[model samples]
Target: MRHAETVTFGGSALNRAAELRGDKADVLALNENSRSIALWRGKPLICGTNLDQLALLPVSQDLFSEADEPPVPPIFLGQSEDGSALFAHDISAWEPAALDTAAMQQFVDPTQQHHPALPDDHRFVELRGVMAQLSARDAELAATARSIFGWHRSHRFCSNCGAESRMAMSGWQRNCPTCKTSHFPRTDPVVIMLITRGNKVLMGRSPGWPDGMYSLLAGFVEPGETLEAAVRREVYEEAGIRVGAVSYLSSQPWPFPSSLMFGCAGEALNEDITVDPHEIEDALWISREDMLTVFSGQHPTMKPSRKGAIAHFLLRNWLADRLD
Candidate 1:
């Protein structure tokens, strides 16, 4: 947790410039004047690509192509120290391609694509590789794009007035035509923790995860609940572990449909795990050494957490004695 900001995407100190969101003229001018820029789905975009993922897109193409092409909302990622534009694309429009594992696999497997234009640094490729090879920033960008775009597609109607809303503020907000209400993009807070007692850490596998894959216990923070309380409640509700002394570790923007995962390391007061059949298929405590084996691919029944996820980062640092 101490070296959290040093963690891949977690460390890129890009200037998000939240204060400038309202300055429409200056933003438009900056986008037009930016030297090194990337176009996502046609809106000008920027992001501090500390890792070379931004160059993965096949030559810059207008994000909004074709007369009938749907709108692609562009998010202002941030600016580099040299003032270069850093941006991200909402490829959630291409979600169907990602959800279809077969199609997604083809994009990553270099030998399979008949005419692959995507770069190796692309999120789709790095996701398929072994852990630690992919930078956390790239993963964050991909996830952000997917989640935000997915939100736009799903929340086209205003909840307050049942009227259609339009994309505004560079995909960061939506404005309802009927009630004149402004809705901002949402990142649901989720608590993902490594519940440890002695040398064993608690992990669980969801019903849909690939076979042998297990991760830290996690759940969304309910309305009006504090983060610490959410961590305690989630650990107990999902794994039946009574947690005490919850400590925040790190946070990651998980774009898998718009979520912000808050990583934590908590002290477990109880060892007995009564798995919630609805929340998790199975749960167990794995020793530190066993976790190392899992990380090294020596464990046959379990696969480590997804590379770009905060769970994987937390577990890796925890194993490396760097999470203290």
Candidate 2:
């Protein structure tokens, strides 16, 4: 697809400084520089008023050392325009009373309130709620910060010897000091397909989705499987439909704990669905005209997928003949 890179979290050309990952002195210098961004949890600091771009704070800001708390180590995100170093520092250990309730939620707390000691115009907003409003650059930065930090949070223990691991390579890897094993951040592949036959397309909804919410069928790519195989398998397993002639469309970096979604277009060989109750609650085919109604908010039975997700992007482009 010619406009594939225009998808959310797709277009930024971040200059990941791989050479400096192992340089202790240079990494420290960049951390102390005044052009770094301090991210609390996964939310990047943004202007509470504008909320369209990143509000990068200086490294020496009082917020970092508030209550006599030492600033956390910085992870180099790469150089941005003007050749200034762009970094992300995890201030999650701050443990402010305002954020006490956020610890219980599996996702980032969407509370937009300002930190008690921070400036009134600055606050942290969850990326999913405001991603469509952010510029491509800000989206990229937020996605990268979330993915790296999530990996660090889940990979603190070694898989090889069941021993605890230490951070290495400036947040890109973990090393087991006892077993001499090294672990790198992982990105699982998922296949999300637009299966079509004649004028209708296939979609399914998992349990717990909002009322009338439906999206393209998707599942993780299993071990040693090709993208084509995964697409076929997922469709068959979920909706009991066989797919053929799979073709790649576009992709997005889904950073809810780090996964890449490969969007694909598949030709459905059969329309009869026998849904697996274990995988999804329901599956059905919707005509193009009805889909248009759903998108326009005139349909009563279903609603289109949320904006900024690949499913919405694909369906919109398909409707407008922009998928080429």
lDDT of each: 0.65, 0.83
Best candidate (score: TM-score): 2
Per-prediction TM-score:
0.78, 0.92
TM-score of model 2 vs. true structure: 0.92
lDDT by residue for model 1 (1-324), tens: 577765444565556655555455235434544422233331113222333343433113443232124735455555556664445444334322223446444423322111123343323333233213444554444455556666777899998999999987666789998899998888899999978899989999888676788999899999999889999998888888899998888887655557778888899998999988987899999999999999999898998777766788888888888877
Instruction: Provide the lDDT at 89 for model 1.
Output: 47
Pick out the ten consecutive residues of candidate 1 with the lowest summed lDDT: 107-116
| Highest-scoring model, lDDT | 2
Give candidate 2 misplaced runs (Cα > 4 Å).
24-34, 66-71, 99-109
Q: Tell me the alpha-carbon RMSD of every candidate.
A: 5.0, 2.4
